[model samples]
Target chain A: MSNTFLIILFVLIGGGLFLSFLRLILGRKATDRAVALDTTTLITTGFLVLVAFLQGRSMLLDVALVYSVLSFLGVLAIARYLDGGLR
Target chain B: MSFMNILAHVVTGLGALVLFASGLGVFRMPDVFNKMHAGTKATTLGSVLFLFGLGLFEPSWLPKLFLIILFIVLTNPVSSHALARAAHNEPSEKPDNLIIDDLEESKGGDQ
Candidate 1:
């Protein structure tokens, strides 16, 4: 049953990631791409956490935690740069 | 599968479905603010739901899962807010279908 759930999740996240890529490619504004990138990082974090659950490794959750924090910083930096809020 | 396991499956599945819808919104939304609205809100909730589902499967992991979810909830809106402000000020990408330029008006400049 869990295996079936895993397969279903894989398909769902995969489709989401694909859509994010499409938006990133077709986006006219940098902010649109930023939003897409943010979504992609989120999906990746969820994927990492799922992998940790499947593999029975607690350390991978830490990786997901770090990845999320760093991605937030990345988005903030990009936003700051775009807004001329940075010196 | 037991009822508990079924519940986990249902919750996680819904989370993933929400993430997919967020991506679709990003692809189809007309402007930056709309896209940010869809992306941040849905994805934040979806990720929290996903973590909560996993915590249900293994009670031992619940604390850490909650921590992660809390961080996401706090940061997602903030980052989106910053990005929206930036997008509004961007010189090259004029927002299509913009209804109000309150920020522009407040700036009191022709920028």
Candidate 2:
């Protein structure tokens, strides 16, 4: 039963990722693309958590946690650059 | 047979739906600011729901999931706000009917 639930969660995360890719392809503005990328990162974090559960590995969550922090900082840096405030 | 399991599934399903809608909004919104709003708010909440559901399903992962949720709530809005401010600063061909120029006024001089 847990395996079945995990499978369903995988499908959901996969589908969300595909949709985020579509957004990345269709976005015309720089900010739009940035937002899409941010969403993609968030979805990836969720995906990692699901994988951790499937593998029964507690250590994977550590990686996901680090990724979440790094991605957030990345987005902030990009935003600052785009605003011409990076100096 | 377990109510918690049923609730977890429901929450996960809802989170997926939220994420899907956020993606659509990112593609369909008319302006960068609107798209950022949609993507940041919806996807952050969706991810939180997803992680919470996973924690419910796997009790052993409760601590990690809660931490993920906390980080998301802390960072999502800050990043989005920064993105929106950045977009506002960059020059763009305005839409035909845009009437307000608050940012322009704040700039104190026309570029």
Candidate 3:
């Protein structure tokens, strides 16, 4: 049962990541790509947590935590740059 | 499987599904603000649900999961807001659908 659940999860998340990447490539505007990038990072964070659970290694959760923080900062920086507010 | 195990599976599965929908929205939305709406709200909810489900599987990880959820909830809106403001400020990507853009008028007057 757990194995089946894991398979389903991997497929779903992989599909999501693929779609986000597609948007990043096909997006016409900078903000469109930025939104896609944000979604990709968030899904990746969830993927990391799922992997941590599968491995029984609590330490990987810390990595997921840090990744989320960094992604937030990245998005903020990107937004500032796009707004021309960053000098 | 036990009750908690089954519950975790359901919760986590739902989270993954929500995430997939968010991705679809990001890809399919016609405008940047619409994409941000989908990307930010659904991603935050989906990740929080996923983390909560994981915590159910390993009770010891609850505290850290809660911390992550809290941080995401707090920061996702701020980042998205920044992005939306930036998009609005950029003259190249002004939203085409708005009938009454109060911000533009105010900002225009101030300038």
Candidate 4:
């Protein structure tokens, strides 16, 4: 990827992350915050992958992959807890 | 410079834009269920397209990107559903605009 393209991608995802954070804090309910967190994690994974391209490193892809999996697990746990299913 | 490079740039740019839209949806939507819909559907697509474009730029990294994309696609909707269901079951905090709740109708005993 070109340097300019990388910059644009960074700005776009950064804006996305910022908005997601806004939603997280402004959320009225725990479920709303959870959904915002899920969105944030998803955007973060995409950002990480874009950074991998910028840095030209395959190792970063592994980090993104693992991070995505971990976040999904966390979302699941939060969902179960919210529903009173975990108890 | 080349056709392939331009393809990567356009695709990646558009993908990131979609992610931004998803965030906007989460922020501007009226209720939690609507926020879940926007956040999950659009972000799932944005991540897939963003990674696909990235893979086009660097073919060697495509495999790992594919893995991450698949994981996002499979998990996103499921997690959204779980969250929505959890929210719906909260009798005190029902969404104000929830229309025609069939789940509470068909299976009302549990809730």
Candidate 5:
């Protein structure tokens, strides 16, 4: 039962990643791409957590945390830059 | 097989579904702001739910999972707000059906 559940979870997340990637590629504007990128980062973070859960390893949790923090910073920087910065 | 196992599976499955919804919304929404609305809020909730479910699966990993959730809660809004402001500043990304122009008027006085 647990194995079936994990497979379903992976399929769902992969679909999300694929759709967001589609958006990233087809987005017309810079902001559209940025929004897609943000969604992808968030999904990736969750994926990392799920992987860690499956592996029963604590270290992967730290990796996921760091990945999220860095992605947050990246998205913030992109948003501020696009906002035109202290105009 | 166990009660906790079943609960974890259900919660995680739901979280995955919510994440899928967020992606769909981002793909289908008409404009940048609409996409941000779905991407930001849904992604935050979905991630939190997934992390909580994982924590349930392994009791020992609870603290760090909570830490991840805390970071997500704090940063998701800030990033989304910044993105919204950016989208507003760029007239090209503005939604077509937006009836109110309050932000346009406020922008001059506020910033």
Candidate 6:
């Protein structure tokens, strides 16, 4: 039953990811693309957590945590660059 | 197989649906700001729900899942706000529709 749940979870996340890719392709402007990418990263983090559960591994949580932090910092860096300064 | 596991799966499935809807909103919204609003807010909430469900399904990693949720709630808004401000600051080719220009007034010493 856990395996069945895992399969369904994977399918759902995969569908969400496919939709996000479509957004990246069809987005009209730079900000629109950035927003889509940001959403994608968040979904990826969730996907990783689900994978960790399916694999019965505690270590994957650490990876998910680090990815979450790094992605947030990356978005901030990009926003700063767009804003013309670190300030 | 257990009732609790089934409940967890249901929560995760709902979260994924929310994430998919947010993605569609990103593509369908009329403008950048609206897309940002939809994507950032909905995805963050959806992800938190997903992680929470995962934590319930895996009892050993509950602490880590809580930390992930904490990090998400804190960072998502900050980054989204920064992105929106950056987009707003970029000069557009067309004049924006405005009834009042407070920044312009302050610049001209019209206090």
Q: In DockQ terms, which candidate is top?
A: 3
Model 5, A2-63: lDDT tens digits are: 67877889898999988998999999889999999999999999999888877777899999
lDDT of 6 by residue, B1-111 (tens): 788988877877788778877777776777767778788888888987788877777777778788999989989999899888777767651125545657556646954
- The weakest ten consecutive residues by lDDT in model 1 chain A span A1-10
Docking quality tier of model 5 = high
lDDT value for candidate 4?
0.87
* Model 1 ranges off by over 4 Å: A85-87, B109-111
Decreasing lDDT order of the candidates: 3, 5, 4, 1, 2, 6
- Clash pairs for candidate 1: none
Which candidate number would show the highest lDDT if scored against the true structure?
3
TM-score of chain A, every prediction, order shown: 0.90, 0.88, 0.93, 0.90, 0.90, 0.84
Clashing residue pairs, backbone N/CA/C < 3 A, model 4: none
Candidate 3: deviation at residue B40, Å? 0.9
How would you encode candidate 4's per-residue C-alpha lDDT over B3-110 as one tens digit per residue? 988898788888999999998888888888888888988998899888999888898887878888888898888889888888887875468776677888777776
Superior candidate under DockQ, 5 versus 6: 5
Candidate 6 or 1, higher lDDT? 1
What order do you get sorting by DockQ, best first? 3, 4, 5, 1, 6, 2
Interface RMSD list for the candidates: 1.0, 1.6, 0.9, 0.9, 1.0, 1.6
Colliding pairs, model 6? none
Q: What is the lDDT, from 0 to 100, of the residue B47 in candidate 2? A: 88
* TM-score for chain B in model 6: 0.80
The deviation in Å at residue B44 for candidate 2 is: 1.6
Instruction: Judge candidate 4 at residue B103 and give its lDDT.
Output: 83
* Candidate 5, DockQ score (0 to 1): 0.83
Which runs in model 5 stand beyond 4 Å of their true positions?
B108-111
Give the higher-lDDT candidate: 1 or 2.
Answer: 1
Error of 3 at B58 (Å): 1.4
> Could you tell me the lDDT of residue A32 within candidate 4?
86
Q: Show model 3 residue runs off by greater than 4 Å.
A: none
